[model samples]
Target: MSAEEIRRAAAERIEEAEDVRDELCAALHGAGVVLPSLRVEPAAYADERPRPLVELGRCNLRTARLIAEALRRGGAGA
Candidate 1:
């Protein structure tokens, strides 16, 4: 998806959970909003494999920051 699309998706997911604040941070990281390491716990129950940030049905902070960078570089579609 496009960078803007990823950005918006990240924003939406961040808005969904207070605990996901760090996740939002990661998304921003993806957007080039640099910060220290973000701590994200697995949003899963016992006996289940933890899902990747992307598998959360949206882009995480890292992806968002990268997408933002891509957008700035005219590579958003990538």
Candidate 2:
């Protein structure tokens, strides 16, 4: 895929993942489990050819695992 196509696909996936994370957070909150704030940030490096990166931040180990499982069930992960 071209750079533009790659970026577009990445953006769509990022949005989907964000939705899943939000839902997971809501469920956790309802269950009285407080999680750290989650944010998606650009993760591009100053390398030869930089691409887009969707970094999920502010999650501890347990939160990360929970988010991964949620994404997988939502068909956003492998």
Candidate 3:
């Protein structure tokens, strides 16, 4: 993607992630807890994997939705 497109995507992701994180914090606060940092374990690797070990990545608002969904599924959506 072009630099402009990349910047736009990053900005959107930041905004969306911030919004979701804030909502999550508020919900946790109501439940007498503070939200902590996200900790993702490394994915298992296999020699037969089709993709390369290192791959280019992009971020956008969709990532925010994913994060929110993950937290909900983990029972952090109090």
lDDT of 3 at 18: 54
For model 1, the run of ten residues with the poorest summed lDDT: 45-54
lDDT of 2 by residue, 10-55 (tens): 6666667667777866876665454665444444332223343434
Q: CA RMSD for every model?
A: 14.9, 7.5, 13.1
Would you give me the overall lDDT of model 1? 0.52
Alpha-carbon runs more than 4 Å astray in model 3: 36-78
Against the unseen true structure, what C-alpha lDDT does each candidate score? 0.52, 0.58, 0.47
**At residue 18, what lDDT does model 1 achieve?**
36
Model 1: per-residue Cα lDDT over 1-78, one tens digit each? 887776666555544543575666666656666444444434522113333242233556776676667567756455
Instruction: Flag clash pairs in model 3.
Output: none
Candidate 3, lDDT over the whole model: 0.47
**Candidate achieving higher TM-score, 1 or 3:** 3
Runs with alpha carbons beyond 4 Å of true place in candidate 1: 19-78
Better of 1 and 2 by TM-score: 2
- Displacement of the residue 4 alpha carbon in candidate 3, Å: 0.7
Highest lDDT, which number? 2
For model 3, the run of ten residues with the poorest summed lDDT = 47-56
After the best TM-score superposition of candidate 1, give how far the Cα of residue 26 lies from its true spot, in angstroms.
26
Query: Candidate 1 at residue 6, lDDT?
Result: 64
